[model samples]
Target: MPGVADGQGLGPVLTVPNLISFTRLLGVPLFLYLFLATDATGWAIAVLAVGGLSDWVDGFAARRLKQVSRLGELLDPLADRLYILATLIALTVKDVVPWWFTIALLGREAVMVLCLVVLRILGHGPPPVHYVGKTATAILLMGFPMMLLARFSEAARPWALPSGWALLWWGIVLYWVAAVLYFIQAGIHVRAGRAAAAGAS
Candidate 1:
């Protein structure tokens, strides 16, 4: 969603909500660093859980604290993407998840981002964050913890492996579906904006 706020006045960046968003931005790299440094399953689960918590915390603070800024809106999704990307990379590196999964996840995100960039250049606004998108993200976040637990838990926890795999696959499917929807919605917005602009002239 590059430059979606170009002409819009999103207000100052010092507000509480924007501060939370900044914190989320910082958290993304930190989470990645933690995962990269530790090979322990326990550490992975802990850091991932905290990363997920940061996702929720920033949004909650933004809305409740009434400090929402355009920068915050922009950075939130970006942070989420970065966090997911890091986990996907880590999971692939550890062999807990297949390489195909990482490729697909990253490919979808790349496509969505390209669409957003194209839309912005075409004079269209950023696509609305659809419900499907939200659900997709939630599923992925939930899947990561389950996957981590599966890796760390002992043989006594028989359900962890299967449940974690199931959740991970389901989340990947949902994310793909959501990515399709995002592109479709972006196309609609672009067309509408173009038509409006043409008619105005």
Candidate 2:
């Protein structure tokens, strides 16, 4: 918050927070290799935990150490998205979760991409991250590992699947709600930009 002035963007890309973001981005491929190629669920879950911890760590480092950067802002979310995509693919391939669930999540991302493309063509910035969206992401991150844990042992499955399913479903609902807010925000951005253009004209 100290260094982050507005959603417009921030300073140089060379910073600790950006470094952390870079490290997080590196984990995605490694996670996929462990989960999909080697079938190493335990190791994959550990890698995921690191990814989630890094998500928090990088933000804290950015604010507390005043190392926030425009690159970090962009890359942090990108890393999270890739992690989500990788997790879905790995789990689905392992038969831990259904393919349709992955489709639903990816479909939301596809819609967002289309919205962003439209916004860019019209000369408007994409909407800033909303708290609800962040919360949904965090909740889903927590649930995903638990979901894998469900597959770890039959004894754990009874409680783990239910807990994970509960969080996962709730997170999906929250994610869609955030999508609605984003669309509304996109419209607002467009209208504001048009109003500013008309005033200038």
Q: Which one wins on TM-score?
A: 2
RMSD of every candidate to native, in Å, equals: 4.3, 3.3
Compose the digit string of candidate 1's lDDT tens values, residues 1-201. Answer: 122333457755666656666666676666666666756556657767766766667667777766666777777777778778878887788776788888888888888878878887877778767767666776787778777677667762488777777877887888888888888888788778778889999
The TM-scores, one per candidate, come to 0.83, 0.90
Cα distance off (Å), candidate 2, residue 201: 0.7
Query: Which residue pairs collide, candidate 1?
Result: none
Query: In model 1, which runs have C-alpha deviations exceeding 4 angstroms?
Result: 1-8, 155-157
lDDT of each candidate versus the true structure: 0.73, 0.83
Off by over 4 Å in 2: 1-10
Candidate 1: lDDT of 101?
Answer: 81
